[model samples]
Target: MKFTRKAQAKWKGSGKEGTGHLSTASNVLKETPYSFHTRFEDKQGTNPEELIGAAYAGCFAMQLSFLLNEDGFTANSLNVNADVTFEDGSITQIVLDLEGDVPNIDCEKFQQIARKAKEVCPISKLLNTNIQLKISLNN
Candidate 1:
């Protein structure tokens, strides 16, 4: 299966002084703000890196849940957060922090599933940045 989203950005002026609006072909992002200041602070709308982090985090969590269910365990809750760092005009790193509560699953098994999710999540597969995963499991 394959899926794709089309988004466009329009910027004017320079890096520090310029500002831009991002829009999606499907209208998911309608004139969203993307600027250096937005990346640093007041992210009222969205930015490219933040969107990447969100996509990674959400995809990882969903993949983990599926793995848990396949192992005859159900997740009470799953929370995944990804931090994507940008440096030297490229994506430097992506750090994933995940917490999961799975009923009847031991820590070792949970860790294994989390590792699998990190390895197989679509966003992780698509990214070229250095990636790190930190997972915590609770009864």
Candidate 2:
């Protein structure tokens, strides 16, 4: 199976003063405000690294939910927070914080399943950056 998304960006002027527009083939559009002061700030709109973190977190959570269900333990809720760090124009780390409420599953089992899900999730497999995982279980 294969999937693809097409996006384009157009920038004007130098990195500090340049601003850019991003648009997907599906016509979703966004803007990037570049300035010397905000080398790390989100001046406006979404950036690539932020998007990657969002995608990875969402995907991993869903996969973990499915794994829980498959193990006969339905989750009450699953919340995932992903942090992506960039340095030297490359991704340095991706940290995943996962919190879940499972009615009948023990902590050990839940942790085991979560670890397996993290290992097998599509986004985890795709990323080359160091992935750190933290899991919390609630009764």
Error of 2 at 3 (Å): 3.3
Name the runs in model 2 displaced over 4 angstroms: 25-39
Residue 91, candidate 1: alpha-carbon lDDT: 87
**lDDT scores of the candidates, listed in order:** 0.88, 0.84
**Residue pairs in steric clash, candidate 1?**
none
Instruction: State which candidate has the highest lDDT.
Output: 1
Q: Name the weakest run of 10 consecutive residues (lDDT summed) in model 1.
A: 39-48
lDDT of 1 by residue, 1-139 (tens): 8887788999999997789999889897889888878876765667788899988998999998898889998899999988899888898999999988888888999999889988998888999889999988877
At residue 20, candidate 2 shows an lDDT of 65
| Residue 98 Cα positional deviation in candidate 2, in Å, after optimal superposition | 0.5
Error of 1 at 66 (Å): 1.5
Every model's TM-score: 0.88, 0.83
TM-score of 2: 0.83
